[model samples]
Target: MKKTLIVVCTLFTFGATAGTEDSGNELSYEHFVHSDKPIKCLYGYAAEKVGDHDAAIAIFEDCIARWESVYAMIWLAQIYDTGIGVPQNLEKAAALLKRGAHTQDEAGYSSLAKYHYGILLLEGRGVPVNKQAGIEWLQRAADEGVDEAKDYLQSMP
Candidate 1:
C-alpha cells in the first residue's frame, strides 16, 4: 500500500462526488453520481485519482457487478497490470481485459482491451502463448482503428 487511507473517507468522497458534469471529461463527478445517487464506473477513477487504489478497486468491482461496465473492467485491469500500490497480478489483469474485450461503450467504442489482451497473449503473460489468437485480436483491434495495434502488427516480422 502506498499510504493508509481510511475507508470511510473514501466512501465519503465517492458519495459526495463534488460537482456538475463537464462536457469534455468523462471522469466527472456527474458521471459517477447522479441525482439518484447511483455509483457509476467513474467513481472508481475518482477514488484512484485521489490516491486510494483500494477504494478504487472496490468501486470498480462493484461497478462491474452492478452495471457490467467495460470501462471499469479496463481501468481495473490497468491498475492490476501496473501494480499501483499493490502486487502485480497479470492473471487478474488479463482476465479483466478478456472480460471487457467484447463490450462496447455508449459511444460504440471498444478494442482497447483486445489490444492489451493480444499483447499479453503474445507475451505469455498471465495466459498461454496463443500466437494465432493474439494475432486475431490484434487484427480486430487494427480493424477497429487502433493505431497502436496496427503499428504493432506492422512491426512484426
Candidate 2:
C-alpha cells in the first residue's frame, strides 16, 4: 500500500512539474512588461496566442498608435481578415497591410507586409483583384529576400 502511494505521489509531482516547465517559445506577460523590448507588440502576440483576440486588438492598436509598429499592423490586419473575435473587414485588413507595407523599417516588416499584401491582391481575398500590382508587390518582396515570395513568383506560370 505504501509503495503504491509513494509511486502515485511521485507521478503527481512529476506531472505537475512538467506542466509548469516553460515551452521555451512562450512569451510571458511579466517579461513583456518588465523587459526593454516593445511591450505592446509582445503582449499583443501573447494575448493572441492565448485566444484573447480582444486584448490583442487593443494592444496592437496601442502599438500602432504609438509607433506605427508593422508587427502590430500586420497582426491587426490578420485578425480583421480572419474575423477573429470581430466582424470580417477585408477593406480594413487591406488598408492596414498597405500601411504596414509602406512604412519604412530595418526589421523587415515591410517585406512581410508586402508579401501578405501581395497574396491578398493576387487572391482578391481582401482587396480588389489586381494581378499586376500583386506581381509587383511580390517582386518587391522577392527583392527583399522573402523566400515565400520568391517561391510564389517562380511557381507562377
Candidate 3:
C-alpha cells in the first residue's frame, strides 16, 4: 500500500510538473506569428475589449512592426486611424494600407485597395478624387470575396 501511494504521488508530481512546463512553453501569437517579443495581436484585441486602449495600441504596434503581417498592419492602421487604442493618424493608416495593397496577400490587397481607394475618392487623401477607380477597386475586392466590399458595392450610389 505504501509503494502504491508513492507511485501514485510520483506520477501526479510528474504530470503536474510536465503540465506546468508545457504551459510555460506555450506559444502566443507573438511567438507563433509575430516576432520574439510578447506582442500578440490577440492580446491587443483582448486588451482593447477590456478598454485598455493604451495597452492594446502598444501590443498592436509591436505586433505590426515585429511581424509585418498584413493583418497586423491593418489592425494597427485601424487603431491609429480611428483612435481606437491610439491617436488618429491618417497618414500612418494610409501608409499601412499602401503597404498592404502593394503586398501579395490577396485579402490584404483587396481590403487596402478598396478602402484606400474609396476613402481617397471620398476625402481626397493622397490621391485625386477618382470615383470610378474607387468603384473598380471595390468591385475587385467584392469579386475577391471581401465581405465588406460586397456590402459596400451593394450600398454604392
For all predicted structures, in order, the TM-scores are 0.72, 0.76, 0.60
Give the per-residue lDDT of model 1 (tens digit) for 1-157.
Answer: 1111453355466564443343444453334433222344556776687787776787687777777777778888989899996799999999999888777766323577788888989999889899999999899989987788999999999
Clashes of 2: 0
Per-candidate clashes, comma-separated: 0, 0, 0
TM-score of 2: 0.76
If both were scored by lDDT, which would come out higher, candidate 2 or candidate 3? Answer: 2
Candidate 3, residue 64: how far the Cα is off, in Å: 2.1
Clashing pairs in model 3, backbone N/Cα/C closer than 3 A: none
**Candidate 3 TM-score over all chains jointly:** 0.60
lDDT of 1 at 107: 33
- The 10-residue segment of model 1 with minimum total lDDT is 29-38
Which candidate number has the best lDDT? Answer: 2
Candidate 2 lDDT over residue span 97-144, tens digit each: 999989977667888899999999999987899999999999999999
**lDDT measured at residue 44 in model 3 versus the true structure, 0 to 100:** 56
